[model samples]
Target: MLELVVHPRVSARHPQLSDEDVRVAWQNSFFQALRTGSKNSPEYLWIGIDGKGREIEMVGVPTATGYLIYHANTPLSKRVRDEVKGRRT
Candidate 1:
């Protein structure tokens, strides 16, 4: 199991999500993409279902130990949901 380091900003920005919610989402990630073209560290976008069965979207960078999640949200846009569902089929 990879270590999970959630940035403080995650909770600050998304008060509805708890640390455990983020962890479950990461562990259950069904769709992930490497996000390039940033001047900073390489980042990744992950979409997964939490234990409560809610879809969660997370953005973060990989760390030597594991992954550092900086952002997380729910109820993805219709376009994104459609795209992800299409990929699964």
Candidate 2:
């Protein structure tokens, strides 16, 4: 099981999402890639569907024990969605 540690800032930034929503998104991730231009620790970007069936974009960094999710939001940009779709094909 992948342990997910959601940062407190996530709620502040996206109050509409709950911990459960974040968990669901992680579990259902369809696209994930290591973010480019990271300075320190490696950061990852993920796109997944939540329990509500809403597409969510998540950003996080891997920790010693698990992933620390620092950001999550819905309605991903068309460019990003298209990029992911292109990669899938």
Candidate 3:
């Protein structure tokens, strides 16, 4: 059997983005802007990741946390679950 792995990597330019730029990118990609907060003086934004690690499709930057993700191309959650199950020996 062949194992498949998929990971989404944000380009270096993403972190370099100004808050506004990040917002724009977020809006364009996810159709919403994320809220910003700080913990321990470090600013962090909450972005939702599905089981496959891909941001939810077409859902706006969630005003709150706990977004439920579903299939876009393939069911990533199942794949991730399979990977996890495989690792448990």
TM-score of each: 0.82, 0.83, 0.20
Reference-based lDDT, residue 43, model 1: 79
Residues 1-89, candidate 1: write the lDDT tens digits: 67999888888888888889999989999889776755545978799899999899888888888999988888776766675677678
Q: Highest lDDT, which number?
A: 2
Score each candidate by Cα lDDT.
Answer: 0.84, 0.85, 0.29
Supply the TM-score for candidate 1.
0.82
User: Model 3, range 1-89, lDDT digits (tens) per residue?
Assistant: 22211112222323332333323333344222222332322221223333334542211222133331111221224543454355455
Mark the 10 consecutive residues where model 1 has the least summed lDDT: 33-42
The full ranking of all candidates by TM-score, starting with the best, is 2, 1, 3
lDDT, candidate 3, equals: 0.29
Model 2 scores a TM of 0.83
Clashes of each: 0, 0, 0
